[model samples]
Target: MKQFISALMDAHLPAPDGLQDGMAHTAGRRFDVYRNNVVHSLITALKVGFPTVTRLLGPENMNRVAGAFLRAHPPTDPRMMYYGAAFPAFLESHKQLDQMGYLADVARLELAIRQAYHAGDAPAMPSEHLAEIPPEALLQTKVHLAPAVQVIRSDWPVLDIWNDAQTAQSKAQDVLITRPAFDPIPQALPPGGATWILALMQGAKLGDALDAATTEAPQFDMGGPLTLLLLGGALVSLE
Candidate 1:
């Protein structure tokens, strides 16, 4: 019975032959309507989930792209909230969007923001806690980051494109996504900021993370990243 119902939902089979009742006769049509509604709703949810991506692509283009995406990748999970996990990868492979090289990265950034918002919460370690750590141990220590912190790095100016689309007055910018409370917020980052934040989020010691950042971006500023992490609740605890 479950397999039959699944087939009906997927429009794989016709209604079981010859049912006398009018309601039973309409079952196929009803199922088709229901299926359409489900797809529509999921597509709408995807739009909401990746507003920045949608804004970058524009409405009509996004809708068409999303429709193609829906056909290529059907939802496997019951949870609709995380349905678009493959969207960035899908965008990357799409032939039409090849001209816009940064679209895939932008989609990734948008997806990361959604994940961060839904991530489990943990109280951040107080700034004083870092001070209490012995100087010698600081370099070897591993720190935990808040569940809401996510760092994304892309060669294209994805952060700048996102900011330009989102705000009227802001100049082109690179960004770090963080959720200090419940909502994810975008923070403009310095040249090597993403690499630095990625290390911190991965539990690297402060010094090691800084060194990684500097290696990648010689102009990376320690003060800026430190201040951003501390204020944004990215630092959870030091061990």
Candidate 2:
């Protein structure tokens, strides 16, 4: 099985050497056909998985990259949704893409959005609950982000690039993904917003997260992110 899979991914490798005449009839034409179909499917999966990367690199270039990517990282799960999770790192390490350093972050942004979109549904914390928390206790309380909430920190304008690769400004940007309903929405985070989110994710109390955020960026306001958290159904609970 190992030999078959190895040969299937590499065209240069023969089809599980020492095959019977019936299977290897016509110099393994049958296996060749099978291999081509598998490779094509995998490449197509990759293109669909990383559409942003595909468009930036162009179809031809994407195909070449995807081919190499498939050989380096093959699918472990039969589910297509789980494929290409490591594509961002692959792009970052790719010697040819040294000039396009932002590609990896862009891919990470897209991947996060996709993952959030597919995440299981969870009820949003009621606004009344947030309002009920006493001012003094609110800061000491911890908030629970919903299953569909995802955050990504990047050193490039990843959200902008994802929205419009051609004209996106070359500036560092962070991203916040939230699924208020059926579709996941991706937006740029304000200064220190990502830091606050990360702190919350790490189990920090609201006050701690705020202190951390404000210390990093004096102007980091809690109103905006809190509004998004409520409106976007990001906070599932608080404890």
Candidate 3:
């Protein structure tokens, strides 16, 4: 049964051996039609999963890419929403798309948006919670980010490209993903923001993360990134 399904999945192969519908032989023509429909459905799902990539590459090119991607990496899980998890990396490695360096980052931003939208709900740390902590202790404290928080570090202007839905002129841009409500929002991160967030995500203390970020970018300001987290409700708990 597994072999039959595998053969069916690959359009190049003919109908699986001994395939019959209750003693009536399965028609090759019908099998081909079914295969085409299945491939089309999967391609459509990829289109829906990566809208930004589709827009950038155009429907025709995106469709072709989707077909190639599907052949290389099919959905392991039944859930369609998670099907294209590897697409961003795939785009980055694709020979044809190597010239369009920003395409992968754009795909990543879109993927992050989707992930944030589906992340599990968690209570956000209230503003008053900070008042309870002493200033010194707060700096040494480790913060718990909400499940919907995502950070993308890119060498291209990811946020600008995503916002404009087309390539834009800018320098390297890091992005922060947050879901204050049902919809996820992607905002460009300030200098050192990416470093700080990556450290925090790895369980670094606030002070430690700040130090690390400052080392990466001397002018990195902790205030801006901290304010973004607080305002976006991304800080779930502080320990």
Candidate 4:
């Protein structure tokens, strides 16, 4: 099985020794066709999984990269959606693509979007629930984020690259992805917003998260992140 798998991925490898075509003949030409089909299908899967990467690298470049990618990190999951989960790290280590620092993060963003889109659904917390809580109690309350909420931190302008936002790369862009409806939306987070969200994800209460966020970024504001979470269906429940 191991030898057959190896030959399936690499065209250069000869078919497993003594492999037969069921007619008692060596499977030479028939094996080649089988190998071609498997390689093509895997590459096509990568293109679908990482559409943004395909566009960034162009189809020709993508084909080359995808071919190499499948060999290095073959699909382990039976589900196609779960394929290429390691592709972002693979891109980061790729010698040819290493210079494009933003490419890996862009792939990361795309992966998070796909994850959020497929995440389990939950009812979003209502504004009135929080409104009923006393102002002081609000800080002590813990927020339960939905499964569809994803926070991404990057040292590159990944959101800009994804959106073709032509803005200057003055600083890194942190992102928040939420599946409010059928699709997931990726939006840029305010400074320290990612930190705050990360804190919440780690089971911190609102006030504790605020402290961590403010220490990291004095300009951190709670309104934008809170509103985004609430409206984006990320605020599953507030305890």
Best lDDT among the predictions, by candidate number: 4
Q: For candidate 1, lDDT tens digit of each residue in 160-219?
A: 677664443343345777788888887778877877777877767778988998998898
Clashing residue pairs in candidate 4 (N, C-alpha, C atoms within 3 angstroms): none
Q: After aligning candidate 2 to the native by TM-score, how far in Å is the CA of 6 from where it should be? A: 2.5
Model 1 lDDT-worst window of ten? 165-174
Give per-residue CA lDDT, model 4, range 1-239, as digits (tens): 99998888878888889878789899898898878888889889888988988999999999999889888888888788878889999999899987788999999999998888889988887778888999979999999998988999989888888887778464799999988887999988999899999999999999999999999999999899989988898887888
lDDT winner, 1 or 3: 3
Taking all chains together, the TM-score of candidate 1 against the true structure is: 0.82
Instruction: Report how far off residue 135 is in candidate 3 (Å).
Output: 1.9
RMSD of each: 3.6, 2.0, 2.1, 1.7
Q: State the displacement of the C-alpha of residue 73, model 4, in Å, after optimal TM-score superposition.
A: 1.2
Q: What local lDDT does model 4 show for residue 141?
A: 96
User: What range of 10 consecutive residues in model 3 has the weakest lDDT sum?
Assistant: 161-170
Q: Stretches of candidate 3 above 4 Å error?
A: 19-26, 165-169
Worst 10 residues of 4 by lDDT: 162-171
Query: Considering only N, C-alpha and C atoms within 3 Å, which residue pairs clash in candidate 1?
Result: 160-173
Model 4 scores a TM of 0.94
lDDT of 3: 0.87
The clash numbers for all candidates, in the given order, read 1, 0, 0, 0
What pairs collide in candidate 2?
none
